[model samples]
Target chain A: MIDIELAFENLPPWAALLTAFCVFMGAFLTLTGSVGLLRLKTFYERVHAPTLGSTLGTGFILVGSMICFSVLRGRLSVHEILIAVFLTITTPVGFMLLVRSALYRDRVEGNDNVPEGNPTPGKQSAPDAAVQQD
Target chain B: MSASFLPADWPFVVLDWSLFIAQLFLGLAMACAAYRLILGPRAQDRVLGLDTFYVNAMLLLLTYGIRVASTIYFEVALIIGLLGFTGTVALSKFLMRGEVIE
Candidate 1:
């Protein structure tokens, strides 16, 4: 039953253990990232959390899967690289856009703590402005 | 049902146990991401949560692929990866520019 059946049956003990280690480590890293996402206090801080899973966590899992399939089929299976490349390429772009957008929004609404960005209208010129609004 | 899935020997036994562990962790991680998605204070935080959710889900599928010993799962994972990127990019673009296309 080629793919539908249990293919790991053909894998050797060494490769099986290696694959297991890789997959477990990846899952653990991903869990750590999720924990970080939940525990971080600020938005910017939270933004940093998911990257752990996306980068190294995904990397490890893909590697493990590659090894598992390669050993199973008796060939070098590396198509999982498509997912990896997409992850590496798109994660930073999306995050950069999201963070920049978030920053723009915060600045537009006059967050004085954020460094000035072309002074777009609502500058919150002084702490008095922030206080007076309250 | 369970017996059919179990391997006949030891090395594969280690793998089965590890796959179980990996699945458990990934599921919990997905829950954490979902929690953030539902409860985040801001729209950006929600988007961030959504991003993490899809990535975790993709990896989950990959592990499932290895567990089932199917390359078909790779296609599913690839689709998720592609969709995840497109969705996040569009949402973030909308967030940043206020209009997705303009």
Candidate 2:
């Protein structure tokens, strides 16, 4: 096993403190998000839970990582930024697709909990209503 | 060593304690997500649980990398993030269209 003391002996006090703070916050947020996911009743509510992790949870952790590595190597290590960017860009898209698909399936199954027809204005037509009816 | 910038021992102590606590929280998060995945009443709930599990796992990996002072795990964590998102997208697509491909 790698010795923790030996590995981090060179870590400055400020950097160590920052890393600890970031990691702690990140982990706490993730845990809260997961707990929310488990406790929420509906799939739509649950869909909102993981966003906590994908957003702030991921942001804090990646920032902590960047700080730790940059301080340890005595050089800027910003590669973890890639993860933050990728997650920020993709998470909403994924969630949007998932929620839309779930709504579509629910509507197709005639689940009354979800609103039927185009709730949007300027797009109401008999053919669309007919398609939904059939 | 840039330890000259902050010559103090308290931060290291704080770091050790916080790292342990963070790991504990992350583990609990993973357990919660697994519970949802296993006990979900609906398929979408299971998929949502799985997505949460992946994100938690990736965060856990980042903590592990910090603990070990290794950057290799960063790449692994990145891959997990990318692949996890892709898997969820595919799963959602399959659910929506009844198939992944047209």
Candidate 3:
């Protein structure tokens, strides 16, 4: 087996501590989000769970990665910033589409748990609203 | 090699061990997401679980990149991130409109 300690032997204490703290915190947040996703009672509640990971959990990991590579290369390794930016911008948009889709689906099913709103643009909602949509 | 090291590197052995612990947490997080993906009661729930899975997998790969000190892994993680977003977006659009392109 490869020696983990030896491989990481030269990492500076300060960078090591910083990377470890950020990684641990990110991983902890990710795990918490996963638990929430699994244990939440409703689809809407569960939908809110993974954003914890997709946002700051991912942000922390990317920051830790940027620091690690910069320290390793002794220069700015800002490629991670691309991932962070892309993720930050895209995650919310994807989740919004997903939650809106879920809401539409729930409303179509007439699940009664949905908040008040017309299922379609200008008509009374019904269980068959899905089939009757323009 | 610009790896600045303190005079005593042995005292910080916790670094590698802590990285290993973080990896374990990420793995467990992945398992939880997979559980939801495979067993979710509704279609949207499954899609949400898939969304969680891809994001966690991307971050996990990023941690591995740090562990191995390889920029290639970071590249792969980026690709995963991009693909995950596109895929989740497409899936949600399909769920909403009954077709991705329409």
Candidate 4:
């Protein structure tokens, strides 16, 4: 219902085209990342997939939006950069913890898919039963 | 007030349509994330789901900003992204250590 136009009047044709390309590319990457996250077989794999979206996808789209707005409004529009910064900084920490937890659970139940690491002796590697679920 | 600078053809039109389509795609991504949260065999999957949800929401807001041609939307979206990031970190740390405080 809301109709927002692309104000490309002032700028040359090339800038608009570039912005469009950036937006579409960003959207495509984000879509791919989400699809990969859903389709990946294992938890670790899924954890890696969405990072594509959080990283490059967010970066591209935010850049596109910022450019479009700045060109249209005739002023700087760099606030979206803050979102980019926050996401890039925090996403890895969350992902690492999630992976660690999954690894912990697998080891507690003795799963083979979970590779053993030198975290804690005897409890570090997942037992056999955990791997069966995989 | 800014109409003097406005182009003969409304620029918001292109931006809005593209953003609407983008929002639809982002919504689908959120749904996928939600599925993982619900069907997660373990608690970690749920946390991942929640984390994905937050990111998708932030992106959606950016698209909305494009739709409205207002920088205000971007600010709110930025805040949400920050809050979501912090919340996810806290939840994930809790899962890893069983105590978020430590």
**Quality of model 1 by C-alpha lDDT:** 0.86
For model 2, what is the alpha-carbon lDDT of residue A13? Answer: 82
Look at candidate 3 and give me any clashing residue pairs. Answer: none
User: Which stretch of 10 consecutive residues in model 2 chain A shows the poorest summed lDDT?
Assistant: A119-128
lDDT of each: 0.86, 0.86, 0.82, 0.73
lDDT tens readout by residue for model 1, B1-102: 457766557677788899999999999999999999999988999999999999999999999888888788889888888898888889888987788998
Candidates in order, interface RMSD in Å: 1.7, 1.2, 2.1, 2.9
Could you tell me the lDDT of residue B4 within candidate 3? 57
In TM-score terms, candidate 1 sits at 0.86
TM-score: which is higher, 1 or 3? 3
Q: Which ten residues in a row have the lowest lDDT in candidate 3 chain A?
A: A125-134
Query: DockQ for each candidate?
Result: 0.64, 0.72, 0.57, 0.37
lDDT of model number 3: 0.82
State TM-scores per candidate. 0.86, 0.89, 0.87, 0.81
Sorted on lDDT, best first, the list reads 1, 2, 3, 4
- The residue pairs in collision within model 2 are none
Better of 2 and 3 by TM-score: 2
Q: Write the per-residue lDDT of candidate 3 for residues A1-134, one digit (tens) a residue.
A: 33556556667878888888888889889999999998999987888888899888988888888877788678998998898899889988898888878878876675856755454466544544554463
Query: What is the clash tally of candidate 4?
Result: 18
TM-score per candidate for chain A alone: 0.80, 0.85, 0.81, 0.80
